[model samples]
Target: MRKLLQPILAVALGLALGLAVTWIAGESPWHVLKILEKGAFGSGYDFGMTLFYTTPLIFTGLSVAVAFHAGLFNIGAEGQLTVGALAAAVVGAVWSGLSAPLAPVVAVLAALLAGTIWGAIPGWLRARRGSHEVINTIMLNFIAAGLTSYVALYLLKNPDSQNPETRPIGPGYLIHQFGIFGGAPVSAALPLAILAAALVWVLLWRTSLGFEIRAVGQSEPAARAAGIDAGRIRIIAMCLAGGLAGLVGVGEVLGNAGKFKVGFSPEFGFIGIAVALLGRNQPAGILAAALLFGALHKGTADLDFETEHVTRELSLILQALVILSVSADGLWSWMKERRRPVIPETAGGVTC
Candidate 1:
């Protein structure tokens, strides 16, 4: 229960700080809250859009959480998702005469494979070459960006459109959107994301590989001493993380856009870091955190029209504050330890 309360308290602190900022900016915090509430849940369309935004965050959050469990910070989920989405788009656009289930399944597999390969590159570097995963992942992001742009612009450019997007996918590649969303593009991807989260929980808690991954994360040297191949675990964990991030493409390309738009992602991969941190790298917690951030993203859209002093950028500030507040938990613990009274030890080595 104490562990559960930690994240909740941090979130509350962050929200209080954000509202105070709003007050300082000459805006009524109450008005801001009301506007955000209305913008996010005012209509079925609004709520569905929030879920739409949430779907990708779930994938990316799981991606980061998986890598975190393996003692790796996978900063390249953005790159992995970019490459994976392109792979899905290319497969969907070029494949012909395929049936419904087969077409979508093939495209999704392509995404997962591409993401796995992209993630594996850095994982291999860290495991074999003694290179840092963070640096390798960061470099991969730039490479993925440039590579995807070249493909979208030259290789598979939509001839009829001037936008930097691929050709439209086949009809069979398009997933079914829920009518309950009031014509919003909320699709079967939402349920798939939920299923993925559940599967991740099962994988991390109910498997030997998961045990090895967690053991490696706690201490690589100790895992090595226990005869576990730490390098292999790291690589496998990263591969899984990348594949999860790649699933974001399923919702973005097949479910919503039916094409690969260069900037379709509003940094969902990056926002996932915050989600993972707030959730304490737990699957169930991540789901809740993703929804909260998703609502914030959708709700802030109305700030431009509804509020005079506050804008959508306020959401960024709020997100940053939330991350800071959560991070401060470590510092708070350290401070408490420092202030704790020390007991003197006797000559016999017993505490006095």
Candidate 2:
């Protein structure tokens, strides 16, 4: 019960704090909250948009969660996704003549390969040179941005258009949207994301490699003593994490946008960290958390028109507060501990 209640309490506290901020901004918190609720679920279209935003969050959330399971922090999901999207765009554009069914498959494979290689670099450095993954991943993000930018600008740029994006991918490469909400962008990727989550759950709990990864996360020394190659596990975990994140590109580029845009991501990679943390790194929890954040993203779109002082920035504030509240569990426990009275030990078996 405590485990279940913790997240609920944290969410409540975060919303309470967000309401306080809203009051300070000279707005009615209740009104703003109502607007948020209505906008996120007012119609089928609204719900579909929420799911559309959620597809990528699931991938990125799982990417971070998988690395956390291996005691590794992969902050380079942005880079991996960017490069993977570029690869998918290139494959789709240059090989437009491929058969309908084969094009998307090949594009997806290209994305996975690109992301795997990008992720493996930092993993290799960490395993072989004792380099910190956090630093390496951060640096890799910048490199990926520059490299992808150059390719998009110089090589993949559609000669007929001014946008810094590749040409339209072949129709064969596109994933069909369900059109459940009258032409919303929700595509087959939503189901794919859920399937990936299920696969990840099975992989981490039902496989030997998963056991080794968790064992390494618990203690490298113990894992080593037990004949597990901790370094190799970390590297493998990182690669898997990268591949998961790379799927974000498959959804956005191949499924929705049909091309790689220069600034397609709205910091989905970084937002994933909060998702993983709020979800407690559990697959089911990640799904719930992703949906919540997705709702926030979808609802906040109309803030400018709904209120005079409030804007979409309220979403960021709410997200930050939630992260802070969730992370403060330890500090709250520490404070309680400090306030507890120490029991006196009596000498000679005498009690006070």
Off by over 4 Å in 2: 335-352
Summarize candidate 2's per-residue lDDT along 1-352 as a digit string, tens digits. Answer: 8777788888888889997898999999999998888888888889888888888889889999999999999899888889889999999999988866899889998998888888888888998889999999999999999998898899889887798888888889998888677677888788889999999999999999999988998899999999998889989999998888888888898778888999798777887887888889899999999999889888888788999899988888888888888888675675665587754663334322
C-alpha local distance difference test of each model: 0.90, 0.87
Instruction: Tell me model 1's lDDT, rounded to 2 decimals.
Output: 0.90
In model 2, the worst 10-residue window by lDDT is 343-352
Residue-wise C-alpha lDDT for candidate 1, range 36-150, written one tens digit per residue: 8988899999999999999999999999999999999999899999999999999998994576989999999999999999999998899999999999999999899899999
Could you give the C-alpha RMSD of every candidate to the true structure, in order shown? 4.0, 4.0
